[model samples]
Target: MKVYEALAAAFVEEGTTDVFGMMGDANMFWMNALAQRGVRQYEVRHEGSGLGMADGWARAAGRPGVVTTTSGPGVSQLATSMLVASRARTPLVAFCGETAWGDQTAAQYLDQGRFAAAIECGFVHLSRGDLAEEVVQKAFYLARTESRPIMLSAPMDIQQHEYEDNGPYVPSTQLIDRPRLLPDPSRIERARDIVAASKHVVIIAGRGARGSDAGEQILRLQKRTGAMLATTLQAKNWLYGDTDYHVGISGLFGSRVAMELLQEADCVIAVGASLNSYTTEHGYLFPEAKYIQIDTAPNLVMGNGAVADCYIQADANTGLAELTASLERESVTIEGFHTQEVRRRLTAPLIDPSEFRSQPDLLDPREAIVVLDAELPPELDLVLGSGHQTDFGTMLFQRSREITSNYGMFGAIGQAPLITIGSIVASGRPAFVVEGDASFLMHLSEFETAVRYGIPILVVVMNDQALGAEYHKSRAKGLDVDLAVIPTPELGRVAQSLGGDGATVRTTDELRAALAEYVRQPRPTVIDVRITRDVLSVPYRRLWFGEDV
Candidate 1:
C-alpha cells in the first residue's frame, strides 16, 4: 500500500464517514483513495467551503470532521474558516496536500507550518512515509482533544511512496478518549457556599455546557437556586423551550430582556462558559455580580474577560452535577425570579413589526422574518448567517434542535452557505440558510455546489443592498456609508440560471407563495427577499442610542 492508501486506512480506522474538499492534483490521489474506501465525498466549489463544511459536520455530528485541500492557496483559503472553527471549539481534521518533498522552488509551494501557526491551528507534516499513519492519527488526536482544527500536510511525492506499515492500525479514539476530569470536592463546596450566600443567581452556559447532561444539570441547579438560565450565543439552543427564567443568548446580539434580567442577578454561576467579552458585553451586563465560573480547563488568564474570582476547574457536566448535588443540600435560596411580570416582559416581542412603519417597494426585514418564522417547517434545519439580518432572524425565529448560525466564535458570515451544505448532507434532511446579501455573495460559488449535488438547501438572501450592521452603525456614528452599500442584483434569477428554483420576493404575499412552493418541492431554492434598510434590530437601536426599543 502507498502512503495515500495508508492515510485512507487511518481515516477508516478512525471511522470518518464523510470527507469534504476541493480536490486538486496534489490531494486527488488520497481523495480518490478515501472515495474508493466508500467515504462520502462532498466536493465543494472552493477550498474554504470544504473547511466550512467540515466545521458544520463537526458541530452536527459531535465528532471530528474531515477536509482535504491542496497546498498554498488551498491552505490559505482555510485560515478564516479555521479561525471560526477554532473559536467554535469544533474538532476538524484537514488533510492538505503539500508540494513534492524537497521542492522548495515550486510556485505553489508554501510554508504551511507558518500559515497554520498564523491562524493558531495545529499542523503536522508527514515527513516520512513510514510514519504517515502516525501523523494522521496524531492529527485526529489533537483535533479531538484540543477541540480545534488540525492540518496534516501530505507531500505529493511522499504520498505516492510505498507505506512501510510496522503494525496494525489502532484507532486514535482509543488513545484520546480516556476518562475526563471531575469537579474537585473543595471547589464544589466553595461554589455551593457562593450560591448559598447569594439571594439572586444566574447560570450562563456556553458550548462547554452543551455536552453530556450539563444542560439538564444546569436547569436542576437553576431550579434549586431559583437562578435564571442564560446561554452564550454559541450555546443558544442548549435548553430549547422559551421561558421567562430561560434568558435567551447573551452577547452583542443579546435580547434586551436577557441583558436586563442578567443585570439584576447577584451571583452569576457561569457553567462551562468562557465568560468572554462578547457574552458578558465587556462586563457591562454583570459588572457587579459575583462570578463563579466552572470549566474543565480554567487556565491562567491574560485578559479581564476570562478572569473569574472563583474558578471551578472541572468538566462542565461533572462540575455542574457535583455543584448541583452540593447545592441541593439546602433549600431554594430565593424565589420570584420567574414572576408573571418577568414572563410577560420576556414573551413580549423584541421588535414589534407593526410599530415599525412599512416600506412601499421593499419588504421590512422584520416583517419578512415574522412571516418566515410562521411559515418555515419545524423539521427543516435552520442556519443564520452573520449581519444585522441575523440579529432579526435569530431573535425572531422559534429555535429548534436543528438550528445553527454563524453567530459562533468568530462571527464569520460567508461560511454559512457551505456549512448549510454539510449540515444538509449529514442529516439527510432539508435545511434553509437565512443570510445577508453581502455574506451570501461572498461564497456564492458554494450555492452552485449545492445545486450540483442536489442538496435540498433553501437559500434566503436578505438583500438590503448593504452590510446591514455597518450601514446602521456608520449612519449612527455620522460617517460616510457609501462604501458599505453595494449594487443589489437579481440573485434569485441567478439561482434559476444555475438550474435551481428561485423567487424574488418583495411583499409578504410573494414570500408566502415562494415558501409554499418551496415546501412542496424542496431543492436548492433561492428566495431573494429584498429588505428595506430603513428598519433596524432592537439591539442595534439600543447599541446606537441609549434606548432598548
Candidate 2:
C-alpha cells in the first residue's frame, strides 16, 4: 500500500468525511486517492481559501477539519488562515506536503516545521512510513485537545514509500481517550455559596461554554438567583433566546447597560471564559465583581489583571449543571434580582432615539446597523471584517442563534471576504460579510471567487471612504485625519462586472429594497453601502462616553 493512500484511508478511519485543498504536485496523489475513496473533496482556488473552508466547516460542524496543501508556497498560503484558526482555538488538521526528504535543491523547498512554528501552529513531520499511523492519530489528538491547528508535514518521498503496515488500527476514541473532567463537589459547593451570597450576580459565558447546552441550566440558575445573563463576544447568543436582563455583549463592545450591570455585580460566574483584557476592559468593567472561573483546565498562574477569585477545573456543562442542581435543592431564589426595569433597559436596542446623525450625503453607519439588526434575514450567518464597522456589526447582527463565523483572534482586516466565501461553500448557508472599504479593497479578487463558484454570499462593504478606525483615532489624538483617509472606488460596479449581483446604496430605503430581493434569492452579491462616520466607532466612543473607562 502506498504511504499516501494509507494515510488517506487513516483519515477516513478517523472520521474525516470532507477534505479541503488545492491540487499541487506533492499532495495531489493523496487528495486524488481520498476523493476516489468516496471522501468529499473541495478543491479551492487557493490553499489559504481551502484552509479557511476547513476551519469554518470545523466550527459549524463541531468536528475536526482537514486540509491538504502542497509543499513550500502552497503551504505558506495557509499561514494566515491557519493562524486565524489557531487563535480562534479551532480544531483543524492541515496535512501539508514537504519537499522530498534531503531534496533542498528543489525550487519550492522550504523548512515546513519552521513555517508552522512561526505561526504558532502545532507541527509534526513524518520521519518514516512505519510511524505514519501514530503521527496521523497524534495530529488529531493534538488538534482536538490543544484546540489548535496542526500542520502534518509529509515529504513527497515519504508519501510515495511503501507503507510498513503495522498492527490493527485502534479506533480514535480508544487510542486517545480525553477525560471529561467534572467539577469537584466541594468546589461546586464553594461556587454555589458565592453565587447565593452575592446580591447582584452576572452569569457570563464564553467560547468554551458554547455547544455545551448549558444555556438552559444557566438560565435556570439566573432566574432562580435573580442574576443577569450576558455573553462574551465569542459566545454571543449562547443563551439562544431574546430574554430580558440579558445584556447582549460584555467588554469593549458591550451594551452600556451590560457594562453597568457588570460593574454592579458583586459576584460573577464566568463559564468557559478567558476573561481577556478586551472582555474585562483591562480589569475595569467589573471592578466590584469577585469572579468564579469555570473551565476544563484552570490556570493556577494568572497575570495581567485576570480576575479569578475562585477557579473550578471542570467542563462548563458539568460545572454549570452541578451549580444549578445544588442551588435548586437549596431553594435559592433572588426573585427580584433582575427586575422588569433592568430587563427593559438591558434588552433595548442601542440606537439613538434622536434622529440619526448622518453626514449630509452619507448613510449613517449606526442607522445601517440598527436597520440591519431589525430586518436581517433569519438564519443568515455573519462574516464580519475587523474594524470600527465590525464593532457595530458584531453588536447589531443578531440573526444567528449560535456563534458568528468571524472572530477577532487573528484580527486581519482583509481576510473576511475570503473567509466568508469559504464558510459559505463549506456550510452551504447564505452569509453576509460586513467589510469596510479598506478591508474590501484588500481582497477584491476573493469576492470573484464567490461569483466564480456561485456561492450564496452577500458582502456588505461599509464604504466610509477611509481607514475608519485609524481615521477616527487620528482625529481623537489631534493628528491629521487625512493620513488615514483613503478614497474608495465604487465596489458594487466591480462586483457587477464579475458576473455577480451588485448594489450601491446611500439610503435606508435603497438598502431595504436591495436586501428584500437579495435575502429572498441570494446570488453572489455585493452591497456597497456608503456610510457616514459622524458617530465615532464603539472603540472611539468609549474614550469619551464610557463609565467603565
Computed on alpha carbons, the lDDT of every model, listed in order, comes to 0.82, 0.78
Candidate that scores best on TM-score = 1
lDDT of 1 by residue, 1-549 (tens): 999999998998888999988888789999889889999888887788889998888888888999989878888888898898887778899999999987999988999998999987998899989988899889999998888899899899999999877888888888965566877788778778888888778888877777655767777777788788877776765676734477677766677777777888778888767777777777788867788888777453412445676788887778888888787776535673757787688768777656755588698888888888789877888888887888888777755555776875586778787788888887888889999999998988888888888999999999999988899999999998887899877899999998899999988999999999999989999999988888878778877976776
Per-candidate total of colliding backbone pairs: 0, 0
Q: Output the lDDT of residue 458, model 2.
A: 87
lDDT string, candidate 2, 73-140, tens digits: 99999888888888888888999988899899999998989889998899888989877788788888
User: What lDDT score goes with residue 295 in model 1?
Assistant: 78
Q: How accurate is candidate 1 locally (lDDT)?
A: 0.82
Q: Which stretches of candidate 2 lie over 4 Å from their true place?
A: 164-173, 240-242, 300-307, 398-400, 405-407, 543-549
lDDT of 2 at 205: 83
TM-scores of all predicted structures: 0.94, 0.93
* Residue runs of model 1 more than 4 Å from their true location after superposition: 242-244, 300-306
